[model samples]
Target: MFKVIFRVTTEVRNTAGLREIKRAGFIPFMAKREGEEEVYEALYKSNDLEELREAITEAAYFLNKVNRKGGNNFATIYKVNDNYVGKGLGGLLGASLGLKLGGIPGLFIGAIGGLLLGEILDVELNETFVGVYSWPISIEQ
Candidate 1:
């Protein structure tokens, strides 16, 4: 599965601007101190591979539509890998639980379910660009 994350970031003092972002299909994601500003980040995710690959174009389209209306909205995409420990860990947890509940069949079922959940978690984690500051990246040193 592919995940495309679109992010909008602004200073904490400009939180009121977040309302507009929300209306634009962005959702609150995180906040943190960056230099002199407390940055707030909001994101929108697209799981379709085609959309993910073309996220920049979508961002350009959005900017074209909104900017013409005197909107200052800006968006950017972050790239991240697919592999993470969560998937394997979740599969193991699921298999153990499934084995306890229904032996071989339950193990397989639980593993599949757990793997799906883990995949989602990994995508979200990647969306945050894990291992980086939780703030507006550009503002950081």
Candidate 2:
């Protein structure tokens, strides 16, 4: 199995895109909003490299279709070597935890720690957000 992460941006109402495509992607784990746009992050897998790419393009198609302004959607094949996206996620989590644990100083420490761990995930485990980062979602009760 090819370990990977899939990501895309969709209309908030259309976040169900990934779930619909492969029926295998994890529910989005992160949501980031920029001004008026939102993106979602998820980690999952496929049979192999080829299968993974197919799922990603399918996700890209879904995301693009629902975009309000004909925006471009994207996906990844299997994984990226650097996996900066994972690092970013780690950084965000670290920062939040740091704030809670030790305030501003801890924030820096947490971010660095998270980033290093993310790097380890990318290298040792070959697990990282294999797709885009320029996108978010939540489950509603």
Candidate 3:
């Protein structure tokens, strides 16, 4: 298994922002530095290096998009953060694709497409208002 750390920087310190990170399945740690508010430090772990990398990428993408509008404007100042729970979901998905699918190329294309779809669904479902959305729900009988 591979372990990775990601730092998430935001403009303000509040529960709403932290909740977003937590809901995404990340282990969030906050620290208040001189002349700065609370900043979130997130950690992500995966079963493989590739999966960890992919999770970092996905989490970065999600964080960027979430902060793009007008509020938080969080940026990844340091390593990619994926140690949270939602981030784990992304890593698991990548690992599954690698194991069940064919090669790296295929996995890359599939993950990108999946991420796109996830964003669209997040918008189309009108769940973005509450900062919660459905993520590729699967049902088993």
Task: Write down the lDDT of every candidate, Cα atoms only.
Answer: 0.50, 0.53, 0.42
Give the residue spans of candidate 2 off by over 4 A.
1-27, 68-73, 76-141
Models sorted by TM-score, best on top: 1, 2, 3
lDDT of 1: 0.50
Worst 10 residues of 2 by lDDT: 132-141
lDDT score for residue 73 of model 3: 33
The alpha-carbon deviation from the true structure for residue 107 of candidate 2, after best TM-score superposition, in angstroms, is 29
lDDT-wise, the better of 1 and 3 is: 1
Residue-by-residue lDDT tens digits, candidate 3, 16-94:
5455555555655443433333345554333354454445445555555445111233323232322234334454575
Clashing pairs in 1: none
Candidates 1 and 2: which is better by lDDT? 2
Comparison by TM-score, 1 against 3, better one: 1
Per residue, candidate 2 scores C-alpha lDDT tens digits across 1-141 of 343334443446544554444454433445555544554455444445656555544555555555522233333334535457778888899989999999999999999999977755664456444444222221111
Residue 6 deviation, candidate 1, in Å? 5.5
Worst 10 residues of 1 by lDDT: 130-139
Better of 2 and 3 by TM-score: 2
lDDT rank order: 2, 1, 3
TM-score of each: 0.42, 0.38, 0.33
The digit string of per-residue lDDT tens for model 1 on 39-87 reads 3355445545455434334433443333211112233344445676889
**How many backbone clashes does every candidate have?**
0, 3, 12
